[model samples]
Target: MPGKDSKEGKNKNQILADLAMADARRMIQAWTPPVWDEGRRPRISLLRAKKAVPSADGTDLVDWSREERNLGWDMYDKNFFADVVDIEGHHYEVFKFEFIEDISNKMKKALDDLEWVALDG
Candidate 1:
C-alpha cells in the first residue's frame, strides 16, 4: 500500500494485497475442521444466491464469491484468477499468483502420480 501513490507503487499495493489474502486463508483453514472429501463440487457464488455452499475441501465458498463481487473483475486489469481461502472464520479471494510456486509443486506431484500426461523431457 505504501507504493499505491504511483504506478510502481500501485503494483506493490496489488502484491501486498495478494500476500495478505493468502495469509488470511491459511489462518482460516488451520482452525476449521478438516474436510475429507474435498471434491464436494462446490457452487459458484455468482450463480447461486443466499445459500452458503461447501467446497470440496468443506470450506464455506459463499464468502469467497461475495468478496469477488465486492472487488469486481475490473479491479485487477481483468487478468487474474480468484481463489477461496479461509482466514479467521472468513473466506476470501486469494490470487493464484500468491502461491504459484507452492501450487506448481503440488500439481507436479499429482500429475506424476496420475501419469496424467508425459512431462516435457
Candidate 2:
C-alpha cells in the first residue's frame, strides 16, 4: 500500500508534468517558422526520448558540458537523448519519455494531436 506522502508526491510530479506540457504547447503554437521562399516553410522536428527516469532533486538534469541556457521552457521529463527542434533547426532535448508516459491519458492525446502541428510547419 502507498502512504499519504507518496500519493502527494506523485500528485506534485503530475502537476509539474502538466505544466511543462502546457508550456511546450504554447511555445509550439506561438512559434513562427523562419521565412522561406514563396510557398515554402521550414520543417520543424519533434523528437522524444526512448526512456526517462524521474529525479527528485534534478541532479540528473544538469549537463555539465552543455552551455546550459534556458530555451524559455522546461522539459520536466528529464529526457536527454532525444531533441525537439524549432523551425530554425535548433535542437532541444527537453522532455524524458518516462515522465511523459506518466502523464494522464487525456494529456497524452493532446500531445498526439500536436504532432500534426509539428509536421504542418
Candidate 3:
C-alpha cells in the first residue's frame, strides 16, 4: 500500500545508509592502532563525536544523514566504552579512532552484505 514516492524515499535512504557506512570503514582503517608500553598511556579522548568526510564523486556521494551519523556515533561509543585491551604486560586503552574504525568496517560489511542479498533477491 506504499505510494511511489514513499518507496523511492526508502530506496534512497537505504543507499545513503550504505554509502555512509562504507565511508565509516575507510575512516577507521586509515589510522594505525597505537601500541604503547606498560609505562606509557595514550592521551587522546575517545568519547568525542568525529565528523566522517567521505570522498566520492557527486553522483556517488551520499551526504550522510543525521540518523547515519548517530548510528556511527553509537558504534564508536560502544567501542570506546569497551576498551581495556591488554597487550603483553602493557595495558593500553585502545585508540578510540581505531576502535571506531573497526566498528565502521564491521557496520559497512554488514550493510554491504544486506544490500547484496537484497539485490540478488
**lDDT tens string, model 2, 75-115?**
42223213352221112223345344433443455455557
Total backbone collisions, model 3: 1
Clash count list over all predictions: 6, 2, 1
Model 1: how far residue 113 lies from native, Å: 55
Instruction: Write model 1 residue lDDT over 1-121, tens digit each, in one string.
Output: 6535544444564556557878877896676443335434222212112233334445343345454533343353342222222222122222246545544555455445435333331
Return the TM-score for each candidate structure: 0.23, 0.26, 0.25
**Candidate models: Cα lDDT each:** 0.41, 0.41, 0.42
Task: For candidate 1, give the lDDT of residue 10.
Answer: 41
Q: Write the per-residue lDDT of candidate 3 for residues 36-69, one digit (tens) a residue.
A: 6753432222222233333333322322432352
Error of 2 at 31 (Å): 1.1
lDDT of 3: 0.42
Q: Which stretches of candidate 1 lie over 4 Å from their true place?
A: 1-10, 33-63, 67-121
TM-score of 3: 0.25
Candidate 1 achieves a global lDDT of: 0.41
State, as a TM-score between 0 and 1, how close model 2 is to the true structure: 0.26
Two-way lDDT contest, 1 vs 3, winner: 3
